[model samples]
Target: MTLSVSLQHAFPGVSLDVRFDAPQGVTALFGRSGSGKTTVVNAVAGLLRPDQGRITLGDRVLFDAAQRQNLAPHRRRIGYVFQDARLFPHLSVRQNLLYGRWFAPKAARRAEFDRVIEMLGIAALLDRRPGLLSGGEKSRVALGRALLSEPDLLLMDEPLAALDEARKAEILPYLERLRDTFALPILYVSHSPAEVARLATTVVMLEAGQVTIAGPAHEVLADPTGARGFGQREAGALITARVSDRQEDGLTRLDCGAGPLWLPGITAPAGAALRLQILARDVMLARTRPEGISALNILEAEIQDIVAADGDGSAVLVRLQLAPGAGDKTAPEILLARITRRSVSALSLAPGLRVFAVIKSVAVAPGAVGPQAI
Candidate 1:
């Protein structure tokens, strides 16, 4: 399934103009507060009508300003999970979930209740009231309710935003399972880069109400240009990798395009495909191979672009392209190096400069590694 949206909303000093394609799996709507990520999602959920826009989910037209077509939220076959779990205060978890099934047309109710319950691990909470559940449990129940309704597309507005770090960690794996099992399109909204990197199959980046970048999670989330769009401190790179071998010392080796990298943890299975994020600040660049370094990764790349951050003596952003001979030419696997202004001038760094991006093993985010290679 695919979602295409071209929406415009105006409210005095604030205006939102978002346009992007959200493919199947999870498409994360990411931006800082007031960047209009929620507005776009609300438009998709039919909670807010765009001043002018067209929204299509597969062949169904959810909204079209020119045609004056707007599907009510109930009729849109879209499920929305707010930051708050919003479960019924008086109802048991089972009853709350049953309420979702009540909204579906008889013939359209195809998602098995048992299946959804299992997928969300909410079976044990069936008899418990919302007040009796933990924060993560409530969110999982909310997700189960949404799935029970048999939605064609799911809209999660920072589902974990209200949870603490421990709660967020508790829920991420269930979400990964949901993403793998469901075929419906999902538009997940969040401001957290770690969450976006962990969950998004596609990323739509917004800035001041406009879409700054949109593409596969790895491509858009990791590109230096794309990272700069998020600001220097947030810029980084991501690579598709998987656990290839696990050492007894708890260090897991991941097979990446550049080479193997060892990181702490052996939770992921061997041969599962995983995506690894290499933060820009954690990377150091060298023109030639450096010796006796404690860092575990050094990917061969060529400088693709160079731009000053802000001030002359502050920092410079260097973009790199990996394996230039790859088959796809649109955008090669890219990496970013954020170096001091002094270093840029010292090396005369310029576009097309061949270099190695050294990444410290410890800097790689935990659970940021993708599934073991398939």
Candidate 2:
């Protein structure tokens, strides 16, 4: 399924002019609080009407101001999960989930009730009430309710925003499973880089009521020029890897384009695909391979580009392409490094120059790793 949106709306302080196509998998509408991320999602959900342009899900036209066509929210065949669970306070979890089936046409309700419960791991909570469930449990139940609706597309407006770190961690795996198991296309709204890095396949970056960037999540996040959108400190690269082995010392070895990377506290079985985030701030660039270093991860890389120092002129961002070893040229990967302007000048770094990216094995926290795309 595909979602196409082109909208124009003007409010007091925000004027939104956005256009993008969200293919299968999660497409994250990412930006700050007032960046119009929710506005775009509301438009898609048929909750807010745009003054102009069109919105289409596959062949269905949800909105077209020029054509004088607009589908009411209930008729749009779209499921919405908000920041809050929004479950019926008096209803049991089972009843709350089954409530969605009432909106789906009998012929269109093909999503099995039991399957959604299993997928979201909410079967055990069926007899419980919203007040009795934890934040993560509530979110899962909310997700289950939405999935059971049998919508063509799912819209989540920062569903995890209200949760704390532990609660968010408890729910991420279920979200990943939903993405991989279902054919449903998700339009997810989030400002957290970690959430987007973990869940998004496509990323649409909005700034001040406009789309500043939209593309593959990895490319958009790794773009040297787009560091400011994601925040300088949070800027980083995503690597697709597979767990190759678990050492007796309690570290997991992953094989990627950059060769083997050792990470602590990873319990995924060998051969499991994973996505790892390497934050630019945690990387160090060296002109030559430094011997006898405490850092356990060093990869031969070539400078692809150098972003000039930020507004404060305190640091520079460097983009590097990992060089594949002999007889292995198919795998390609990119890494980003944030360093002082003085270091850039001292090393005389430039595009095409060979260097080593020094990374501490423990720098990649457990939260930075996620299940890879199936």
lDDT to native, each model: 0.83, 0.90
Those runs of model 2 whose alpha carbons end farther than 4 Å from true positions after fitting are 329-331
Please state the error at residue 216 of candidate 1 in Å.
Answer: 1.7
Summing lDDT over every window of 10 consecutive residues in candidate 1, give the lowest-scoring window.
323-332
Per-model TM-score versus the true fold: 0.93, 0.98
Residue range 1-374, candidate 2, lDDT tens digits: 89999999999977899999999999999999999999999999888989999999999999999999999999899999999999999999999999987878899777589888888888889999999999999999999888888889999999999999999999999999999998978999999999998999998999998888899888987787656688877888888888999999988899887688989989899999999889999999999899987898889999998886378887888998998866666657888999998898999999999999999998999998999977
- Local accuracy of candidate 1 as per-residue lDDT tens digits, 236-281: 7777775799898878887666667788854777877777777788
Predicted model with the maximum TM-score: 2
